[model samples]
Target chain A: MKKLLDIIVRIFRFIFFIFYYLKELVLSSLFIAYDIITPKDLMKPGIVEVPVDLKNDTAIIAFANLISMTPGSLSMDMNPEKTKIYIHAMYLHDKQEFVDKIKNELEKKIHQIFE
Target chain B: MIDWIAAFFLIAGSLFMLVAAIGVVKLSDVYMRMHAITKAASLGAILMLVAVSLLYVQWIVWIEALMVVVFVILTAPIASHMIAKAAHKTNMPKGPNYVMDELEGVDTDIPDKA
Candidate 1:
């Protein structure tokens, strides 16, 4: 019974993750569309270092891809130690806020799904 | 009514693709252009596929649409990541607004040829 319940929970979490990713995909595309249509120079591109907590290679790859697909951000490279990832953002108004948001939202959700 | 909804999605997807094209021309840097192409293009493709799946009643159409969406979503990030990494490796010039580069001087698998 416990094993069945665990499987059910995992499936539910996976479904939720897919919905969350879809939402992100739509919103981010809209945001980019708006940015492109406007004439103003609204972009402030920069590369910021995000510390990684997930150790598994599959998890890391998924996390990087999710980040890339999301709003204004792209995963560029990871350190040799695998402890940090370099992310390039088109509009990075605040570096610390960006790092914290990724950690709290994307990374946490990925951790739940993978682990 | 269903046709209207499908048309709306198709139009919206086309608009997104248009924006991506404009962005590629207007964006000042390689990284920013990659952002425009990868995210917007993939989402546009997915939306169109969704519209196709919605219009058709056949189960096979839905399955095919789902497969295409999966293929697009899976490949987009990997393609963007590879482009970004290559640009970084070759020391491609950044835009004027580029503020910070955390990856600078970090030795990875590829030696910085620039």
Candidate 2:
């Protein structure tokens, strides 16, 4: 019974990984395409340090990569001691809003994946 | 007509760049400075690239612009992570305004080879 349960969990994790990769692939491609075509300069990019709530290197690395892959932003630095992520964003309309976006959106997704 | 659009992109990109510089100067901490530089500067560069691509419309220019975008996207985060880890290991001071520290007590220091 234990062996069977382990296999089942493994299968579920594999499926989840596939789903995450697909999401990343689709989102990144679209970002690249839109960036190439858009004529208007919609980017109000800036770098901001985000305090990371997630623990573990895997979670942090995945979170950083996800941010980098997303449209209009890039992760430039991660302060592990401070648990902060420095992100360079192309569309920073408001500072607090940007922080909320990272914490609520991307970081949430990362927590789900890594934690 | 094309010139107008190109000029617009150029100006917008330059403005973003200026804002990024200001952010770097204005932000209180190292992490904040990194944030200001990366986001604003990347966008500014992208905008400039787009304007240039529109003006030239050459395959080579387009390719170069794409490369810049790709490189920035890939490396920016890695750089940030490295800096953050190093800072943490070195025990950099945080802003007094900082409320909570999740990384507190975490073993961020590197083990000596000796």
Candidate 3:
């Protein structure tokens, strides 16, 4: 029964991965398109650390990669001991909001996909 | 038509940038600040870069923009990881609002003192 459940979960995860990748591709393409047309120097890039709740390394790595692939940010560091991520961002406003965004949005998706 | 597109890109990018900056200022902890910097800033940059590419219509410029994107994609996470690790080693405090700590009590080995 446990093996059967594992198989089913794996299949579901595979399907989810496909969908996630597709979404990521579309979003990245759109971001690239947007990058091609605008003119302004409004970016205030900096590195900031994001605390992580998830314990798995694979999940953490995936989360970092996902953030990097997104438009305005890159995941620059991962402190394994601290369980935190350092990200270099071209834009930032409310740090707590950003943290919450990652925890609630990006990390949540990652946990669903990887867990 | 082109001008309008450029304007839109500029405005959108600026908005993203502004929001990212605000996040850095408003967030209470280092972890939260990192989140603001990575997501909003990356999106803002992509928007701004796209706008520039549209205006220039030059292959080299577009390629350069792509390179920047690539660099950002590659570096941001690595940096984040390093910083987080450093914080952990230094025993940085987690936010009070955090509810659960999955890493707690996972290992029982003691470190050898030099």
Q: Point to the candidate with the largest lDDT.
A: 1
Measured against the true two-chain complex, the DockQ scores of the candidates, in the order shown, are 0.74, 0.09, 0.09
Q: How accurate locally, in lDDT, is each candidate?
A: 0.90, 0.65, 0.64
- Candidate 3: stretches off by over 4 Å: A1-63, A67-115, B104-114
Fnat of each prediction, in sequence: 0.79, 0.14, 0.14
Model 1 root-mean-square deviation: 2.7
What is candidate 3's DockQ? 0.09
Full ranking by lDDT: 1, 2, 3
Residue B114, candidate 1: C-alpha displacement in angstroms: 25
Higher-scoring candidate on TM-score, 2 or 3: 2
Model 3: lDDT of residue A54: 79
- Which candidate achieves the best DockQ against the true structure? 1
For model 1, residues B1-114, the per-residue Cα lDDT tens digits are 999999999998988899999999999889989999988999889889889988998999988898999989888999888889888988988889678998887777845669
lDDT of 2 by residue, A45-95 (tens): 455667898877877777777776565555655443646666655556778
Displacement of residue A96 (Cα, Å) in model 1 is: 1.2
Tell me which of candidates 1 and 3 scores higher on lDDT.
Answer: 1
